[model samples]
Target: MAHPSFSLSRRLRLSLVSLSLLACGAAWAQQAPSSATAPAPTPSGHMLAEIQVIPRPAGTADDRYKHVDAAIAVIQASGLRYEVHGLGTVVEGPPEKVWPLLQAVHQATLEAGAERTLSIIKVSSGAQAGGPRVEDLVRKFRN
Candidate 1:
């Protein structure tokens, strides 16, 4: 038979091991779920508007060309696309950042002689992974 002191020590060790395991489990439970571990909420995708600028009172072809070139340069710096669709340029970026930039661009263009305010056409944000992009269903499908 085990000595009483030895039995007590063994019981303490087992209790310590069990407590350690429980503590570790609690820590893991408290951690926020990551993309790889959690299910996404949205499935397809979201939309962003691309503002089209048409400088009406450009005064001359050179002024119009300059306005378009300046807009393209801003879009390029912002890491967006510049697509030609007959009338104006189409660029893409996150709405939160892009919309404000679009407004600035529109304001600048108008001050430079544009007759009308910029027109924004809805465009899909394509797809992204995790975060707000997760709200986009298309991103989920891509994954």
Candidate 2:
């Protein structure tokens, strides 16, 4: 996962550092304090999507983030179980709800004034009535 050529903002850098620290701490779980608690259990029969929206700025120096906010607003009102992270948002719900929500998020970003926007989404579903959830995968890395 070497990406030495890319430049990220200070906020993004700090967030990455914070996430790395949490992961490193999890790797040393044998020494974790007894008071540490695991993440809540995952809800069953849902799909998962981790999404990031990249909206083209007005110019080389523009970073107003109006478009980003627009996309998040749509997600916020989606009535699904979700968590907003530094790099992306994790959303979980039934397939019927999740798919359209993602589309609306992308469209909202573009409608917010981005000449073009890119939405990177990673989706996962399980074969059984239930599947892996946000809490299931990140429980080890979260308290």
RMSD of each: 26.4, 6.3
As a TM-score, model 2 comes out at 0.67
The C-alpha lDDT values of all candidates are: 0.47, 0.69
Among these predictions, the greatest TM-score belongs to 2
Per-residue lDDT of candidate 2, residues 1-143 (tens digit): 54665446633642321132243235544344334664444556678887777766522346466777788889999989888786778888998899999999989977878789777787777777666556555656675
Residue 112, model 2, lDDT: 78
lDDT of 1 by residue, 1-143 (tens): 76775577544432221122122234434555567655444333333344555544433465535554555556667765444434444544455666766777666666655565444443445457322221232222234
Q: Estimate each model's TM-score.
A: 0.43, 0.67
Poorest stretch of ten by lDDT in candidate 1: 14-23
